[model samples]
Target: MTSEAKTVQEYIDSLPDDRKLFVQKLRDVIIENLPKGFQEGMGYGMMGYSVPHSIYPKGYHCKPTDPLPFMGLASQKNSINFYHMGIYANKDLHDWFVSEYPKHSSRKLDMGKSCIRFKKFEEIPFDLIGELVTKVSVENWIETYESAFNKK
Candidate 1:
């Protein structure tokens, strides 16, 4: 019932049934671990969740809306992208994560300034990824995201 949904339900509804089931599980995991005050919405042609505008409004550099720094599951033509903007911005963090990937972990990352791409539900480590997404505070994320965004 987030205004962001605005009957985004129909969009979710429009998905193929198996995808719906897959997305619902992913959605539940993200929601369960998403940071406080973050909001859910669509982005990059996929379901995205991000920190609210109250915390990050437009025009940091005179842009229309502040780019949301988010971590969420995305469906892409070739793969599912589990974006982790925070990691891509922090080399140490990313290195530590990649180094510490658990024994059973089955995924590899196509990193972005803040994204980690994957192909399927079975490949993700929900607990670790969620912790990564929610671990940093909004203020911290903005600082990191700002530094990274500014560099771009």
Candidate 2:
């Protein structure tokens, strides 16, 4: 469910009580492990971690005024979804995450191109997510994004 909240805290505050803690913990994991030069804000109605325009002046090609989105966290109707652009743009990173997922959670992985959906909140592997966040730095993400989506 897309939120209409204007800020990260507002987005969090709007979540159902059952989802608040899981989402918060996931947010904490991402924030603690994310490399330098990324900023946290609300974008597309979710909690987004991005490379601010100060670091990448071009911004997102689809929306030049928005920051370059690297990751996002949202509470969906049936799951908490984590979106990582690096995993979607970098095959090596995608392969690494796909291979490692089974080791982290007993539940079978439920994922889309870049969105990892956690249907069972109790089984969410914050540690694995933390490690994944550290795998791509701001510079690496920008390079990967440009190569994969911004080719001219």
Candidate 3:
């Protein structure tokens, strides 16, 4: 593994200058359309927007938390990953997404886990992504993630 970057900003800042554009743009879109209370963090390795351990230390697994489920976004080495279903074990909405937006060029979104991996700028439909991010409420996302958190 890499020597994890110090801050989320540092992670993004470290990317190649040319690579910065896609991540930054996607990051901006996510921030604008993200549900309330979610925060941006450096998870795994990318610039992930999460619900913060301070808010949900128990995670989506084990016991339930008072707050609803949340999501995250990260810019990875080869692709930008959108994590709406962290360890959720499943995703019903993924089916809806795949069937609806089935025209990807590189076509590499691993939908069984709700992770949309887009390689380049033109591959993703930002408007649809924005709509998807906006479609689910915080409560629904939490419930959905928690509901399937341990099943798989």
Work out candidate 1's RMSD over C-alphas: 4.1
lDDT of 2 at 8: 90
Q: Comparing candidate 2 with candidate 3, which one achieves the higher TM-score?
A: 2
lDDT (Cα, tens digit) per residue for candidate 2, span 67-148:
9998999998889999998888888999999999999999999989999999999899999999999999899988888888
lDDT of 3: 0.62
The prediction achieving the highest lDDT against the true structure is: 2
* Cα distance off (Å), candidate 3, residue 137: 2.4
Model 1 lDDT on a 0 to 1 scale: 0.65
Q: Deviation in angstroms for 29 in model 1?
A: 1.1
Question: In candidate 2, what residue range of length 10 has the lowest lDDT sum?
Answer: 143-152
Q: Candidate 2 local accuracy as lDDT?
A: 0.93
TM-score versus the correct structure, for each prediction: 0.75, 0.97, 0.72
Error of 3 at 65 (Å): 13
- Candidate 3, 1-152: lDDT as tens digits: 24278786787787777667777777778778887767766655555665655656765444334223355556556766676663343345666666657553346555436567677656767766776677665556556666665467
- Best TM-score among the predictions, by candidate number: 2
- Residue clash pairs of candidate 2: none
